[model samples]
Target: MPEAAPAPGAPPHPVAGQEPGGPRVLLPHLRGFAGRLIAVMVLSLVTVVGALAQPLVIRMVVDALADSEPIKGLVAALVALVLGVAAVNAVRDFWLQRVAEGAVRAVRTRLTAHLLRLPVAEYDLRRSGDLLSRVSADTTLLRNVLTTGVFDLVTGAVTVLGAAVVMALLDPLLLAAAGLGLGLGMLCSLIAARWIRPLSERAQARLGEMTSEVERAVSAARTIRAAGAEERESRAIADRARLAYEAGVRVARVRAAVSPLSMLGTQGAFLLVLGVGGARVASGAIGVGDLIAFVLYVFYLVSPLTQAVNAYVQVQTGLGAASRIGEILAIPAEDLHGRGPAPDRAVRTPANGAAAEGADGAPAAVEFDAVSFDYGAGPVLDEVSFTAPHGGVTAIVGPSGAGKSTLLALVERFYDPRSGTIRADGVDVTELSRSQLRSKLAYVEQEAPVLAGTIRDNLLLATPDATREELLAVLDTVNLRGLAERTSKGLDAEVGDAGVRLSGGERQRLALARALLTDAPILLLDEPTSQLDANNEAALRDAIAAVSRQRTLLVVAHRLSTVADADQILVLDSGRVVGQGRHHDLARENAAYHELAARQLLVT
Candidate 1:
């Protein structure tokens, strides 16, 4: 299989599990964007200063009117204050948006890169839809946190602090009122935080479940249609979606109650400030203008206080998103480094290399030394052992569940043997790098998958650099050159998805041509002629014979005719090597082989 290309601008470091606590994970991403964040903070500070100055300016205008000072000068000061606030706010808004977008882009790139590096085994157990939600929906929530949440947090903090300081200087009695209301609001917010974390986590998980259901329906649309299960599938999807909706509503209820309760605290503070400040003004302890300024500052303080509560809520949501991303990143990726031979090692052909040894050091040939495996269940191959020598084809014939395909998978190292080892050319296959072993072996699977591309692309899958002349030679060897020429685009014609445009025999021939083009020293054929008619089977057998003359071949045969001429045949029953000898010899001596031949059950 071809490896996918790496995405551009991806982060170099790995992103595994979440930090020890939620705060630690957030700190890194925040620190990474600290420079831009600082710029935003500075601009926000400027905006707050401009906003706070408005009340002082209002006080100046009020005092000037009371003293009957020059109207023109006061009017000029008001106009300049208005323009200054507008200019500062405009610049602050522009940079804030720019900084938020940049932070989100960086985060998305890192998350996507980490996800792509996850191991295949992880994918086997994970649902596509759930993973999709982490990449899409969760990331969107994070973007809101970076943009809106961060801005609100910074501006809100500054506004509240500045208002408090001004109020304390104006009237200590009125300041007490603001502090009491703020303390109560903080208490309420802290209580809401307790519920927010768990609710947000549950809501995100439910969203993932809903996404999974939708993805399942789309992926199996044809199956659902053929079985008339549309309504059933729809109901299943709706059930998951309803669960997510309920979870969201639960979070919404908390948020709804919290916001108003926060506003109520602010309202209570406003009433106290008004009553106390009004009495002080009536007693002539403070001027009317100062009281007016103090009240305006109190309103300013409430804005940030309300925003602070909302920011806390947003942080909880972001924590939920980060936890989901961390779960995917934590799956262990395939380890690429080990004690195996380097991939650049030269091919070891028998004619030019060391003598091959069997498990017993007797110079026998390919041997499976007590090999065993399992595909998440109990062992499929248990203590199985066998040998196939060079200069002849060794055919392994078996019943359907005899672990035939599993054995091939071990040799290819698509999976490693759980116990014992497999020796090819006297060296344990586990000792060789995956690329080194695979490059020397030509494998033709039972299904003969062909990708969605031109016929030329499929043939070049094994030997991408094959010359045009080399490609044509292999095509003729497999008797597919005629078919290739018949298409309007010849070798360039689109093969359609999984080669749907081609007949079964054509696909098999295409697979054969691909294997032939590699010119590997070891051929592993998995029922190569299963899809062919007699004539096509004969052609395939002939092609195999011609190629096997220069390579060691292992043929997994279901038809007696396909392996009858083999130098040796290994009869397998229930995952063990039951009989091993020449085809006719086994048929005469082994009951299972004899019964299989008599019933004409061979694929050929």
Candidate 2:
């Protein structure tokens, strides 16, 4: 009964001032890292400046040789310049990479935390594979953009600017030719980047598809194998993988042409500078050393220009992935992360259409008043009304999809009813933060999901502070004392993925034990004995009966006999509750109750 997530193929929620698909939302994350980037920039400045000064030093050495002005001194100066550039660059590389990685880590951590905290409905709409892809691959784009892309752009821009200034000072005509060459390279890079951007986006999306397929197959491996679908699934996954491969190839195809195109421009500039400057040198318009220095500066311009073009290409690719990441950030988290005061320990009487309290002093634990809801498309529950008093057991019996599970889910506030209200202790549940309300109840889902961990880890998930003695006591309540003793590691024994290592009965019992450890005032159990054999079922009936004595219990009971003595029995069919009374009374009078009892061979 978790709220339905957005449709799997639905477009991401839209952002203001942007087209349907966008990625420039990284400004906030970048703003936080500005200070670190400033430090990197200072070091980068020194390295680039040192590198730019090299051509000037060579110019001096060339002139000194022509004038016989002690070439040794100039050579030593050049060597010192090289060492300085190397040292600054090394330091710059370290801090830049570290800061970039730290920024990526920050984004990943925040995005993942936000994802998990999103409302259950959001999760239902989104596929786990796409979510995983955002966390793993999409965030990686930030690293590339921040580190490699930024690094190249920074150095390339500085070197180009520095080279331009020196070449212009040496000869204005040579500078003009170099500019013409760089302009052409920039044009080619822009075209290639434009082509690669869309392809990169397609490739990243395909990668997400591949991830989702693998996850779907792995999680349902047993079902797929039972259905003899190994070949089918393999082909499906292969198809996705092939699509991703083709997208990557398309991106590579565009990217492959970028470097060469950029190189062509640089080479053209080199020839133009050589021809034009050579003419000037012969016409005695410039010194031989000056012409040589101008050519060296042009060479410096070429490398930086080529680097800038390649870095631009990388930026475009990163933006493609970033668009996907931005889409996730855009989806709203329905306040699950909000903080509210702890759920009131002493339950209050139902207020605001809540179930009125009975003669007992105990407060109403759950009250549903004409609650109507749907997964998304149609009404699953229509005008469903019920009340489970503050304490004692209330059992819900219904045919499959009678919305029995949905009722419990609404009471738990997994999804707010589309119409009507639910109250916990007279206070509207919607008024309380999700965490606050959930903290007061312990739940055992129908499937009784068990995480992959030791028995202790699974139990401690409910009550982390519970001591060893307390843990054993709860395990005893669920008839798991023997399980605890039989396993090689007792409470520490491993429960494989989805508790596959444990028997079905053991998993269910362990889940019940974990819930018991919560010590919450209210307990919601769905089909608690569905997986149990006769012996375990009978044993669990006793356990449930005993546990009910101390807490408010709402159970979706599949077997009518199990709830024959429930304080209240709610019989449901198609959505509405058909009857409510003692199980024996319902068995005697309610048509639906009698039919269900007859089907399950239960006589109350």
Candidate 3:
């Protein structure tokens, strides 16, 4: 049974410190790309040095023209300086691009590895599209920060500092004017920073939301079309997109305001330098060549100021992306320890206070004791207890939402019991390693998710080492041999997404065959015969009986006919067991069981 719900207004389970919450958190991940980043920084410095040398060359050229002393030397020097700066700029851009790509690759690899390790429960609440967006879009933002943002920050600072120094050298009055304009620009940028950060965060979140909506629509395209809700879904998606657009516009507005204010400060500085330097030249306080160089220096200062502003903006976006990525990485990964081999004494035994164990000394029994669970609505199961013994068929019969599927999940340890312990064999399931537990059980879900691959690949997923002969034998057991033979490629035939290429019954049989190939000690099946016709259901029932002889089977049987011949039947109502015995005995002794049997007959 499912667990009890938390109290009203209680806070939800927090998954803090798992995701990249902002750019700050990405510093650790950036370590792998540090060497590349350093190279990029060095290249940017070279570019800045070249840019600074330009004005000095111009000043020399002007002085040479006035002095008429070896004018050829000044001309050659100016041409060489121009060519050097251009060459350095080109090389630096290439290096920056390389660094960005490398950083992006590293981020994607780490993020993917982290996400794959997260517990199944985290994935249950997350949308595939949102996760995909984090891996794809968020990483792209971080790449921009590495390449464009970092380069701009380095070069911009160098340019600004060089220009200020040159302006001061040329004339103190011109330097003061430029400094005042730079101060104002800095103030405006600081103010804009606060606004841009939050807006960027909002924009990234909205992008995830938009992606989720689109994914939802596409996954349920058939249902939407059947219900004539395409327009409604379209509107919902549009609404999310509009929210994203609004968030982007807010960030854009801040950027728009910041850029112009910085540019205005640069223009003001330029005008002041022109006025002050022109006066100094006219008074003979500075040479005309020096005044010309001072104006050019002001232009250099603007380059760094603009680069600084843009770098800050990229940092803002990167922080937003980091926050989203952090959310995913923060979720606790499925613990790998304590799930290894159980103790020797922990074999399947009731006296050990553990669940049922396998008959052949294999750890294949499943038991739930006083277990309860909920999913925020209410208690789905309360104090429910049962044991499905090994080498036999134990059928769980219940109405819809009676915690049947939840019980199966507990056996697989998909979700731990909230207040009670579940055990496989004599060991507490929590003590069993996840891989060890999973290795022993073959679970065939109701929908039977099939990857987009060849039929042989899907079957081999259960037991990769299974030979062609073994595969064909299992296929025959599920009565899918005819279907397999009919396909042009036999077992190699392509199964579309979720095995949509096959009919419902065929898909179920294929899933059964896959499970059979695993030859695991225990089989946890959810509605194995739900999609089968009369003939296929009978064939599947026979297959289940054959499989149960050597392996333990716990089946969630919706149709009473499916469990009528079971060795033991546990009838569940709400989250409690209403009856337990053979099907006929339960029908005679329990009114609910009798009613359920009648309802099954009526439906059939």
The model with the greatest lDDT is: 2
Model 1 misplaced regions, further than 4 Å: 1-34, 70-112, 340-367, 387-397, 412-415, 423-426, 429-572, 580-585, 593-600
Q: Each candidate's root-mean-square deviation in Å? A: 6.8, 3.9, 3.9
Ranking according to TM-score, highest score first:
2, 3, 1
lDDT, model 1, position 61: 84
Model 1: what TM-score? 0.78
C-alpha lDDT values of all predictions: 0.75, 0.80, 0.78
- Per-residue lDDT, model 2, residue 548, is 82
> How displaced is residue 594 in candidate 1, in Å?
4.5
lDDT: worst 10-residue window of model 3: 340-349
Q: What digit string (tens of lDDT, one per residue) describes model 1 on residues 59-162?
A: 98889889988768767877887788788778777876776666556666766776675544455456888888888887677765765565688688878888
What is the RMSD of candidate 1?
6.8
True-structure lDDT of candidate 2: 0.80
Residue 480 lDDT (model 2) = 82
lDDT of 3 at 463: 88
Q: Give candidate 2's error at residue 358 in angstroms.
A: 1.9
Per-candidate TM-scores read: 0.78, 0.92, 0.90
What tens-digit string does per-residue lDDT give for candidate 3 at 55-153?
A: 888888888888876778777877887788788778777877776787678778878998887766666667788898999998889877766575577
lDDT of 2 by residue, 1-604 (tens): 3324332223356542243223354555667778877888988888778877887888888888888888888898899999988988888788878777777788788789878776666777668997899889988886777666756897788888888887888888889987898789779877877887678888888999999999999999999999999999999999999999999999999998888888888888888888988899999999888887787787778877777777777777887777777777777665654643223212233356335565585547787777777776666777777778866899999888788887888777666666676778866787788778888889999999999988899999968898989988888877788777886788898888989888889999999989988868899999988888888888888888887888889999888777887899998887888899997788899999899998888853
